[model samples]
Target: MLKGITENAVQSLIASENPSDIQFDIVVIESNKKQEEYAYPCTRTLFPRKKFGFHKYFNLGISKTDSQYICLANNDLVFHKSWASEMLRAFDADPSLVSASPACSIHHPAHGVDLYSGIHEGFEVRKEVAGWCLFFKREMLDITGKLDEGFTFWYSDNDYINTIQKHGLKHALVSSSIVDHLESQTLKSKDEKEQFKLTHNDRFYYEYKWGKRSLFSYLNIKRKLFFR
Candidate 1:
């Protein structure tokens, strides 16, 4: 599943109007023994096989890259020609921006709400940049250390944004940089109950880490009060 989507993502890069302006390295973090092949133009590295988790692998990828800029994209995304340049412009325009991502339908619901609702011409500074397609300078890694391994999979993005903001940095969505995201395509084949459990646990962990009540707990109490 990821193999195909990753291939499409690479194709999108090659199809870009200014393909030559974009250079990238592919880092594949395999969770299984099956080795996927890439015919893309960039150097490729496959981390040792491990259980599926975003933060660990993302950190591993970051460690491997020596570029001044780093852009992380989920395998299930297709980039637009302007995606890289627009995000670059945003970073250049705002020295305070620690990270930036393209506006996409399949982004964090709150961050991309305007784009998903048909208003997509302007940028937005967001509380969190979705993990699916994130762009940032290497300097941010110095400040945040790394994505919290405590959030091995979920809420890592939230934790990442929070960490950056704590250091007086911000992230944004460059509206002109659009991408096609097939959300959760990476987990489509996973058991629903297991997925729910991870999400449920991660939500609570995130809330606790940030010193807030979990949304589920708050909603449950609200429901009980309403019924009473």
Candidate 2:
């Protein structure tokens, strides 16, 4: 898995179960000016400037991947040992499934469904999906284009999901595979004003592409911006 690592969470991941099965290609996204010697052998480190957003960093990792199936995941997510195998089975069962996301308990109010609970035994269309543990066919890069660089930190995944739907591609939840997500671990440090900008920009992009936004979407965006 490709993880954008901050110094804080690296130790916890190492201590988690079955770390050997996980080949962590860790990319450091911030504050490495004087820390050249601290890099680990297996860890692939990147020290991006504050101006570059998570989408840019994520795209950097995606560009380097050679696997036919790619998992674009966050560092805070912990996976089951069987995650890779089960997800592959789901994708292999239907070549039309452009993407398959892991089911989790966390619900985004905008989508009006608990993401993990929405997983079915068969294929289906999904309105929204989280960036954490999003598995996609490599060909999707050529089909929908890369993540929108215009987005600094948020909504890049949502934009990609929108593009997937536009191409009539299908996405589903692989119910058998699960990942524990430590929500907002990366973006939790941002102040209210910066957070608001992220939310507003996300909503604007959705409205620009879809032409209409749902009430749940509006409220969710507002909640993310001002409330938390």
Candidate 3:
């Protein structure tokens, strides 16, 4: 399912609006040797068998690009042709908007249909943008540094949001941009024991790095500030 989604996503981008105007590259990151054929169509495909951490792969990809703007996308997303252009327009609209994301219709764990409606109705301001389909200037990376490698997986996006906000940078949800996300499609399929160990370790590492009393403490604050 994940491989099929990746292929479809690549096809969608190839078929998206104004393909000639949007000069971009697609980088696919995977762990299995058998997946090389699946990722071969991309501009560049990486296969790192070891558990080098999520942020490491992100940084590796970013390091390979010289584009002014960078978008970190997940494999489970189905992007429209206008997606890149819409996100670019948001950055163009406000110089201070350092990072942005499209309002997803089917964000998992919590459906984002309402959030999408609100954003589409012109209420796009957001405290922390999800990493699922995130866009940002390269300068933000220069300022805040690469996504904290310590995060490995969980809370990395939150860490990014907090870091940039502390530096007076801003983020938003680009209402016009759109993507259909099959969220947690891969992670949900993982063995429960492995998933639990990774989740627990990452949560503790995140709390330690951010000085949180507990995982719920961070969630409690985010719920009030953003969900409200």
Candidate 4:
């Protein structure tokens, strides 16, 4: 986990899970100013950080991971106790499955909760994969390459999912696996401009990828907005 120094949510997640079974190596990437105070036994990377964005953080994490199966998750996501086991089973059942995501429901009322009901079904390539919790085989890295660094703010997950589909890889949601997502904890938008920019980025990604070429394209946009 390449967690930012300010992420207290990581501590909450660590406290919730069983230390023995779910134990894995952690790599905390912190700002240079926080290097001394946040230091722990786990691997640490300190940089003169300045708004590197989500894609950059993801790339940094991917570079550090050597495991065959890698999970890229937000620090604010709280996994169900059996999350790891269920995800493992899903992956084992189908080697072709490039990515597996948990059934996530929003934690904060401001983020809205009912938006997630019955959203995790039907395995298809064109569908969006929520970045909050994504588990995938390392082979995908070799195939689809890294998240597009051009996406400094939003739609990085959409770009990745599109790349995965282009490579003919499959993805599914582990219906039994659940996660409580404290949505947008780290990237909270405090101004209208930030919110508008995020929306613009999302729309740009959709238009660039789909381009109104098919009848289903509009439906895809609606599905992503309402369900994904």
Question: Candidate 3: deviation at residue 8, Å?
Answer: 1.8
lDDT by residue (43-120, candidate 3, tens digit) is 587787656567778888898889898888777878776878877876777787777778665652153445434233
lDDT string for model 4 (1-228, tens) is 224423554554465457676665555555335445555443454453665556777778778868777877766667666776677777777777778777664432233323334334334322335567788888888877887766655666666676777777888766656666766754563366556555555555556555633546655664665543
The predicted structure with the larger TM-score, 1 or 2, is 1
Candidate 4 similarity to native, TM-score:
0.69
**What would the per-residue lDDT of candidate 2 be over residues 73-181, giving only the tens digit for each residue?**
7667666546666677777787777787776444333345453353553233332365666788889889888877766656666766767778888887776666556
Q: Write the per-residue lDDT of candidate 1 for residues 1-228, one digit (tens) a residue.
A: 666677777778657547478666666555545665334445464645566567877888888879889877777888777677777777777777767777774554545365523212223223235567778899888887877866755776777777877887767666667786787876776788667655666666678679798667856754554454
At residue 4, give the lDDT of candidate 1: 66
What is the overall TM-score of model 1 with all chains considered together? 0.77
| Backbone collisions counted per model | 0, 1, 1, 0
| Model 4 C-alpha RMSD to native | 7.8
Candidates ranked, most accurate by lDDT first: 3, 1, 2, 4
Lowest summed lDDT over 10 consecutive residues: which window, candidate 2?
118-127
TM-score of 2: 0.69
Q: What is the TM-score of each candidate against the true structure?
A: 0.77, 0.69, 0.81, 0.69
Q: lDDT winner among the candidates?
A: 3
For model 2, what is the alpha-carbon lDDT of residue 39? 59
Q: What lDDT does each candidate get?
A: 0.68, 0.62, 0.69, 0.61
Report RMSD (Å) for each prediction in the order shown. 6.6, 6.8, 6.9, 7.8
